[model samples]
Target: MRSKTAKLISWTTGGFLLVLAAFRAPAEVTYFLLSTRLVGSALGSCVLPLTKPEDIAEARREMTLDQPPLIPLVRITAGADGINRDYLAPGKPSWTWHVTGFVGFVEGVPEILESTPALVERRQGGWFHDSSGAATVAFTGYKPVAELTREQIFFASAQLTANGMDLHWVDLGANYLYTVETSSSFSPANWMPAPGGSWPIAGTNWVDIATPLSGPRFYRVKAELKSP
Candidate 1:
């Protein structure tokens, strides 16, 4: 978004030092020679293109030159790059130029948000998911050998008869954990794991430990997953 003054400065780097030279007692004279050269150099580069169609049409309509291709004698002095990166007439400051003159622009430049991106509320096709699951263990039927005293529930141990009862469960996920426990009484504090009470499987499962009419056994299923 270079300004006319900045553009002019660029073109005259090799010559402007001469102006410094002329200013010092130790310097050489720049003369009125630099003035005309500076003006000519600045104006010469001013013949540039309008990028937008509307600007081109506006230029054609308002053109005020004695010459056939003459555009307005005055111009905004900014090229398309400047107009884009800085400001165009619509957003310009309130000021006027006389003839081929223009004010140089700096500061108040529009900010560019190159880093921030649009918000995404949902995705269309692909998905990012962590594994999840549900599980249940059920004992279909059971019978007691005989009613036992509070003290006999454990040792008098009921013999579960051969009946059409079932124990089964399923877990379809990446990980599953289960425990089989037993108790002498239904008291919560008395439960403990039965013989080979626990096992770890690579969890993708449809498990069915369909034991029929079991003798006081409890089972619980838990599924879990960790992915990164």
Candidate 2:
């Protein structure tokens, strides 16, 4: 009886140690940003991160936005299997905005899991004519991933134009011309158009003008009409 008890104790101790070794905290998470240029150079941005529910809540409370940040894009939680699962409209305090341009995760933290491009969808109000006599309207959409396919790009472009706005590469009058592209590697620096030139004319759909900024990546642009 004594010998059998000793063996059982040893087995249990070994199993416990093995389980401890297998348990480890997750590494830094990566978040995705879908950026869109809003009116008056005010880039409205959204950030979507793969994170735990607690972390998401903490981030909202801890992080401060210099600009009026809107909407809690979404929240993701870890499952029993240790995978991050998305939970949209978690009924928590989130931010939302009518106009957005530049979307990204909070800087200096590797907690964000993925990011996507911001798509524009027109709402009922927030439409007006710009100084250039173009119809400028405000729209909202969610960013899912950084790299979008040609077809995905077109749908977003069409949605903007359907609302009576033209998408164009605005000349910031600085060294870089502002434009949008769909590339596997999405970055703000690459989205800019060449100086002294414009992107594929304003009316072309993303399919016709999808340009690869980097390897196997693509993007498109929509000119906001000042007067609808």
lDDT of each: 0.21, 0.27
TM-score of each: 0.20, 0.17
Per lDDT, the best of the predicted structures is 2
Clashes of 2: 47
Model 2: ten consecutive residues of lowest lDDT? 1-10
Which ranges in model 1 have alpha carbons more than 4 Å from their true place?
Answer: 1-166, 202-217, 222-228
10-112, model 2: which lDDT tens digit per residue?
0113222110001112233434333432432333343344445554444454344345333233331111111111222132111222222222223322223
